[model samples]
Target: MQKQTGFASILLILLIGLALTTLVIGMVTSVRSLQDSSLTTHAQTQAQIKSAIGYQALTGLLKPLTATQIAQINNGVIKDNGSPAATIATYKVVTTTEGCPASTGGKNYFCYDITAKSGGASSVVRAIYTDITTGGGSFNGSIFAGGLQIGHTRNLQGDQTIQVGAAPGGENGVVKGNGSSTFYDDQAQFTLATGITVQEYTPTKFMTAEELRASANYIFYANGKCAKNNLYGASIYNTETEPVTCSSISGITVSGSGASKKWTIDAASSAIPVGVLWFEGEVDINLNSSRDLVNTIIATGDMKVITTNQSGAGKAYAPYHYYLEASTNAATKKTRICGSSSTGIPTQYCDTAGTLKALDTELAKIANILFLSNKNITFDVKSNSPMSLYGNIIGSGGAGGTGASSGKFTGNGTIDIKGNLSFTGEGLTVTNGTVNVKLNRGDSSGNVTPSKKVMTLSGLRYM
Candidate 1:
């Protein structure tokens, strides 16, 4: 009996020892599992932080440290606490030039590779660029480029192919290669042109007056008619407030049909020419004649002239003509003509009461009407020397009394008057130098009185 009790006691002791050993083993396993989990968490946190830094650099939201900005980013990112399992990383930026000049000159490109180093591993951010003209002429991208692993052997070497922007025929998502792709996740954070630069242009505001006055003899046209009339219709005005230098004219031609008159310029001889002409309502005819004669046409028009006391010297006047003194001229000075015949003023202002102009105002009105009427009237005149014509001449084969004072004329002919001539009209013109009888105004007075010459035309000689 005593031996049996002893065996049971020994077995109970062995069982207790076994149980304690098992418990100890389980606790050791639990502790090891917890340690492994903690290590994994720390590694993951480090990876996430590193990746976040890289992403921020790539997107440009966080600008690349301008030596100054970098210091700030680093100070904010890396804490001074001694809780890190690994040492803080250092960074270096590297640049590469492939098909570009060493220094960015015309069309030079660059790639920037930024690597952040640590004890165990390293992280890098890259960017490839084409815009070198923005930042002091150099490649200014992220830290990594060329898909090269940071602190790894798998990084690419040599010229890493880059892309510019979207090409014509490329994939929808991302095109690859230099011909297709515009964006690269490897060589650069962005694509780059083969070689390119940028520049800025600005204009200055300091010019001399002489530079502005370089242009002369400018012609300006306004409204429906011109301010001056040459042979062709009327000429534009030169309102430069100064004299305009122009070439000389020798002669001109005039011809046309209908109520319009055409005047053409002629360059046959050498002669001093008039500067400009003013046509109110007549068609101007420019003729290609050998002499300075421009042909014109006349229509049935009326003449109204008012005379002011033209001169102080006494002068004799006939029914239609006026005899001036040899020296005291009566027709070569200022004279005013009105529309009323019963006003008792001579057609030539023959009374020596004031100064009389050789050119008659009524005649000037008639000429302007014919030139601007744009009608047809055939007449020709030319001059090699300076001359003037006064009074009025009626055409159109109709008794002259009523005439249009304003109209347009068109043609290519000649009517040369070197000296000043007075022409007036409200609606009458010679068109293209064509003789048209429709423009004639018959005896408007309605009186069957005998025809009386109202005025005489002087300084008018035809060839």
Candidate 2:
């Protein structure tokens, strides 16, 4: 009986020991699982922190740089903090000469690949920027102006684009005057081209007067002479204060034809070393012959162009007859003021080899013909005669009035332009005539191009 009792006690003791061992093993497993979860959470938090740091570094690095400076940057790595940090994220910059996928053909742009890396993970960012002033010396559009107004029976036609507003904060528009005037694109009356965009009333500033003068090829006084003095006063035509007559000026040689003549300022002629010409007083360009201008003309005061004879009989004369002749070579080096009375000037007239060559050479060096005036741009037109002009026109004091006292771009006859126009002070008004424009892409091929020295941020991408 004693032996049986001993065996039962032994079995009970063994069972208790086994149960305690199982409980200890379960506790160990639970602790192990908890430790693993905690470690994973800590690692994830570190990674997130590192990523944030890397992004911050990239943003700070790119903020203040100009487009040129950004393009010049070399491939390299930058740390989040100073060199000897305990933990550091990194940003890598890589530049490519080619454009991004969405960039236009022939655009001057640079693409940057930026990679941010930390804690075994990375993010890639891309940016594309354009050179705004790439074609600084040239203009591709037909007409650019500050304020524009057209009257009844008038047509503003062209195959090129038209731009308005030389700089920000200036007034600009294509006035809705009874909706009688018409605009034509690419010889199709009342039509616009596929890719042609009219930037009407955009608030963007262009080059300043001082900036343009600094880029001048030649400086002259009134009456085609060199500048020799310095003076300043309120304009007789406007309220704006400007340099007095002949105080600061550029030079040009005026010759060829009747009272209406050609103004020449060839840099190769040794008289003017540069093709840009600046005049301190009024600039009077009389369109008398088929001539070529290879220089930009800037005037401080008013700029005026008028036909020598106002009577209908003058249209039958030599230069005036050629001016009205449909057969006259529009492509040659000539000043075509107005379209032919019978048929409007064909687009082919302005596409001559000689005219292109002369204009191209000038544009390659200085870009476009920049005609700047402090007061107004006056066009005196006769009845039944059309006036045509080629170049960029800027009136700083707005449009002069029809009266002898008002400073405005006022006219009583039809008008045409193959360039850009801008007015700072007032607006442009054309009464009883049409204003036509045939945009010029300031390049050797006469293709539409962008301005030089202007830059804008195009797009950003992330990978």
Candidate 3:
């Protein structure tokens, strides 16, 4: 009996000790788990704070930068010091959206997707930006000419001044470049030469076929009949000249046939018929021989301009044709006209307008442009001097506005102005002094040119 009682007590004591030990272990584990959760939460909070700080810092950093400064940033020049947490920040421009300009030096807009790290975690956001020049110092664009031979100037097109909200130039039109491209009196402007970077340009990045079709507000027909189109609502033409099965347009005149078609649009025309215009067939532009004029056209066909003789083609394409007062008072250079007497714009503004311009003097300062879209664009431009064109000239991948076909230069050609002028899937030949683009818009491109740029997070989604 004594042994049994002793054994029972010892067993009970052993069981109690085991229970206590198990309970203590359980409590310790629970406490440890809570602490672990708290630590994880704290770490996440720190990461979030760091990410937010980086985001805010980058956003502020890009703002207030000059157009040249922006270019430096894009080219990895790293001019400014980034935020402390973002010392390891790196970014690539994921997307760039280009918009038509009101003038040569207006804002060139673009958007980008960035992936950044602030040491703890990674975050992604979209940024929209725009770069604008005053005028007459740049032919802006990042061009990839297969056989580059330029002598004059070229400027890459600029992009939208996109903000957290809102939508997106011409004469008095300033062309915008995305900071990666430029033009010069390098191409023989054929005096037509611009840009040196050997980058293959994918036209779809600027405009896609579907996007092109969707962008048009009106359509014109072969029967000389026109109709209001897709996004033509709220148009000045809608109220003034509502054309449905209409006979003709007032301000626009068309002449010639095939690659020699001559199309003219004058602001002097009773009204500017369409906002964003598109044409099905190739276009011919009959430039004035005796006068310097300004015209705007956006087409999905071949853009044709009347070419002039070699001497005439060698003449500069002056942006100050209408503002003759400035052109004459400009640098000591002669006017774009084929003349020994006419004076061009002063070197202060026009000379710098050339793409890659370094503010030199003695070179004729005026520049012009020719734009081609993906759908089908033919610029049959015939002019006395180098032709200054506006709009896209050639598009590849059938992604944007127009197409390019084989043609002969019945006349000499010099191109002034700025914008996208990419060619592809064809024989590539270029020369120097033939094309020139100066994109200094501050004073020469447009005297009253206005500049505004905005950027912000388009969306914030966590991964």
Candidate 4:
């Protein structure tokens, strides 16, 4: 019996030993699996972090780069100091013309391929960016010129900003002039509240004088008459004396009385389909103040305005305002031009094609009269004639072309302007009576908004 009991004890000990061995193997397997998983998770985290760093570096360098410079960048590596690995992240820029949509006008888009590696593990990320213009050609300032001058009592309010190029025979590109007979900023008669902000002058790339003349929808010559008897009431003086004789004649609708005339021009119904009107030579305007609404007028020579004496409170309307490409000459006496009691005219009357829908909808469009010349812009404000201009005025030189002599802006008598006055000319001189100048916000683009260059990111991927 003792021997049998000893045998049973031995068997029990062996079984317990086997069970202990199995438990040890299972624990070892679990530990190995856990360690492998932890290593993989750590590598992935490092890779992700590195990838983020690379992406940041790429985006940081792209904002200020011009389109030409961006196109030249390829296979470029940008490093970040805060990277987790010993080596900084690597980046490659690939430009492709195939991917960009047709709407971008054949402009090339950019592809950024980024790679980051740590501990033999790597992560790759890709992003695509589309090129665009932020605000088109930079206007730089509200007024741009080679030289500037201002007259007495000339209130230049509402973001009175100006940019001047190098003057003729002046050092650097600094502007020179001011005051009654001078064109220097220091000698100007107006007081500088925040002071006149000056910037280096750059030629206007927004639109050129030659381009304006070439794109003129209506071309008028000297002694052209804007007769009220015909439909659309304007005729170019040619061989034909009829009101509708001109090939590009258009009509204007006018309303109101005295200094309160409202004008509307229809783009669709007019013989000249476009909004631009070009005057080739000196033209005279003899509108029976009762029937005329003017749009954009681009003059190549000189412009003169005269109203008939049969006045029963003459009314006029001009929505987008006028653009005088050359010089201007108007009646020195008080004559009612145009005015509006309403905030703005309806879009149906202003723009028929709806191309200027934003102008119609937002009412952000400013009614401005811009005189771009290399000569002089004269505004006659005589006594007993309260000449009041309801829009902004921009008198600039070099409207004829580059290297042209800067023009002059002169005003006389009781001249009342409800908007800003900006001049990039030889000087501005206002004499005789009180030259009342107020400020109003108007559209700078007339009524047309042209497309500009811009850059934006689109497709993104990871590898």
Candidate 5:
């Protein structure tokens, strides 16, 4: 009976020892678990704080950060708030090889890989990224909103200017946007304060021909009649004449020679002789020489119809010489100068001489015919402004060629005109063959005196 009681006591002591050992084991496991939880919490908070700060710093850079730049953070290329140190959080930017939302649409984004360490164990928190948005937190110093890279808005205006060289590689050349205030998707449109308009003018018709003629200062007559008579109430200057009957004729000869020809008529020795020659073929009234037709006469014939054998040959006749000589003869009617000799003379037809010689009539007719023909010839005549030539301006050239000789003109043939040239003034005398030009100077009050100014001619050498 005493031995059984001692056995029970030994069993009780063994149970108590087993229970104490289990309690110590449980306490140790609880302490270790709490420490692990604290370590994880601290690591996670540090990583989040570091990532937030890093993202803000990155966004401050404005321009997108390259992958290599973000890689520096992952590779521990970073600094703490006060020192260069490696934190629990590692970050990088990837343009590819990651399915991150920041890398969506084939773009790049910032990525952070966080790990918590305690004793010999580690916990990893991965897959944090950002995208651009209007208002969203950044990650690892990277721009983020709506899980994509963010872009800023720009407003440009005309009154404002910009500095471009502030950016890199843009030191010398700067393009400014001053016209438009805002740009979107690389497009810009602007407005202005004012616009533009246009206007034109039309003129009224001028007076009729007869009206102008009646009111004009000068009269123009052609072919013994005024062309503008129907427009202006101007009468044609016409004279009546009768034909004459010749009783006898003398001092007349028709002659031609090899390389030369002439039908000579001389009335200087005789009182007055009038005769006519009938030509069987077309005739040429040759001037002095074929090469010098403008200044000389080779022969005179009954060739009433004058033909030019050379391209630039000219016929020049002066009625003044003939008119001055015919006035002396009483039998030569002055009014019958160019009209039929049977007509009575107009007093002005004769100069001081009462003689009405037929020579003046013939010569006047020749001058009129030659001068009128030259009016149809075309030549290079230019002026600084508009100018009028009162008389005939004859240029010498062969029948169809442009010069008198093989390749030469009769004389220095160029006509160069410069400055103001007028046609009519008080002293402006224009005869049948006169080269009339007007020169004038304006006074301080803008008044002009045409006769006082002179036109200078240069480079005109008679060849």
Candidate 6:
């Protein structure tokens, strides 16, 4: 009986020992599971934080960057960078013609499918990007001239003071208004802002003539390269859907040869022509357009802005030179170059910013139409001509195309301008009309206020 009792006790002890061992094993397994859960939670939080960082980084890096460059970064064409390998963000880019709600057509918006990691955890976010150009470069003054000639004030409020630069021969230049109003080389009567350089006024400073020549939706070679007016090749911006003139006469009318070649261009009545109107020879440009999409003109020769018919024509004329913005001489046509007519800050025309625009007018002129010339310019109109030029003009040499008259303005008209002028020409020869130049620094690109873009997007926020 005693032996049986001893055996039962031993059996009970063995059972208890087995139970304790199982409980300990179960508890250890539970603890390990909890530890893993905590580790995963930490990793996931880190990944989310990293993803947010990438989202915000886009604001600074979006502009001055093109979709091509972004793709390069995504396709590993660009080197990956990060302190720790796991901390870097990885992304894929997907472009769509109709992706964002604002995108009516075209690749208007881009999205980033981003993946960021921490330990074994990964996070993803999809971000759409758009920009607005509220601020960028600004106009230095109403008029910038290599020389100034003023007989009398035509417009009461127009730019009273003209910015002057030295002509080629170290001539102090001349302003004919305040003093004798003479065209001969004389002292400047206005405050000489000589610190303002003439190099800044060159349209080529913004883009070269060759670069513009390549981007033109339509081109005329006074050099007689191709047929005058309406280029024959496929347009870069798909803008050559129609011609400017309805009659047999092409848009460009040429009369002379060499530097004196006279090129006159008519306006597009059917559709607002897109891309640059690049002319190889000097021209009398008629500038005015409703749509702000593509309206810029560039000339290799001299420029003359025809404000009205030399005969008494009642209608207003813009210019024969470059049309950087949608600003028209006729106030009735106020569609800005980068925005709608007096709408909120320009959004639709806000652009994909990049240095690649010298050849891409589709995006280059979306902000400002660098309406400039490498040669001299003439704002041609009678003093009483019912006209007003609401845009800015810049050019190179004098009334002479870098020749004997290169150092002076011998053009037969008043130096009257409604906007600003910056040139390296000798001076104006305003012998007949009143100086109507009022410092009317109107909003750039035709907007009531400047709307540059593609501007900073108000919707760009961290998710």
Score every model by TM-score.
0.20, 0.42, 0.38, 0.40, 0.22, 0.44
Residues 244-308, candidate 6: write the lDDT tens digits: 33223355567877667777765433243333456777777653332122345667777765544
Ranking by TM-score: 6, 2, 4, 3, 5, 1
**Between 2 and 6, whose TM-score is larger?**
6
Which candidate, 4 or 5, would have the higher lDDT against the true structure? 4
Better of 3 and 6 by lDDT: 6
Off by over 4 Å in 6: 1-136, 143-145, 152-162, 167-208, 223-249, 256-261, 267-275, 286-295, 307-362, 366-371, 399-418, 425-435, 444-463
For candidate 4, the TM-score is 0.40
Instruction: Give per-residue CA lDDT, model 4, range 1-463, as digits (tens).
Output: 6657688789999999999999999999999999988887788779878888878778778766767787788876656555553555787765455343333653557787788877667888887877765221313234445454334334333344555555444435244333223433442433254234555554442332233443333334334433111112133222212333343354533344333332333322323232334444433333343433244444443333333344332222233443221112232110111112121122222332222233432212322333322233444333333343434344443443333444332333333333334445543222223433333333455423222345667777786
What's the C-alpha lDDT at position 462 in model 5?
10
> What is the number of backbone collisions in each predicted candidate, taken in the order shown?
142, 53, 157, 22, 45, 34
Ranking by lDDT: 6, 2, 4, 3, 1, 5
> Any idea what lDDT model 1 has?
0.26
lDDT of 1 by residue, 1-463 (tens): 7658689789999999999999999999999999887776666556445644544443352332132332243212322247564333323332343222243443232333334433344454443333221111111111101111111111112222221222123223222332223433332332232111111111111111122121111111122222222111133222433232222223423344333433333323333122222222233233222322211222122111111121221111111112121232443322212112222222222222332223332221122111111222334322221111111222221111234222222222212211111112112222223211111111111101111111111111110
* Candidate 3 deviant stretches above 4 angstroms: 1-11, 18-22, 37-42, 45-249, 253-281, 287-293, 306-321, 324-407, 411-425, 428-463
Tell me the lDDT of model 1 at 233: 15
TM-score of 6: 0.44
For candidate 2, write residues 176-251 as lDDT tens digits: 2443333422223233432334555433344544445544434553344443211111211111223333322233
Whole-model lDDT, model 4: 0.43
Q: Where's the lowest-lDDT run of ten residues in candidate 1? A: 141-150
Score each candidate by Cα lDDT: 0.26, 0.43, 0.37, 0.43, 0.25, 0.45
Single out the weakest 10-residue window by summed lDDT for candidate 2. 230-239
Q: Hey, what RMSD does candidate 3 come out at?
A: 16.0
What are the runs in model 1 whose C-alpha is more than 4 Å off? 4-6, 54-89, 94-463
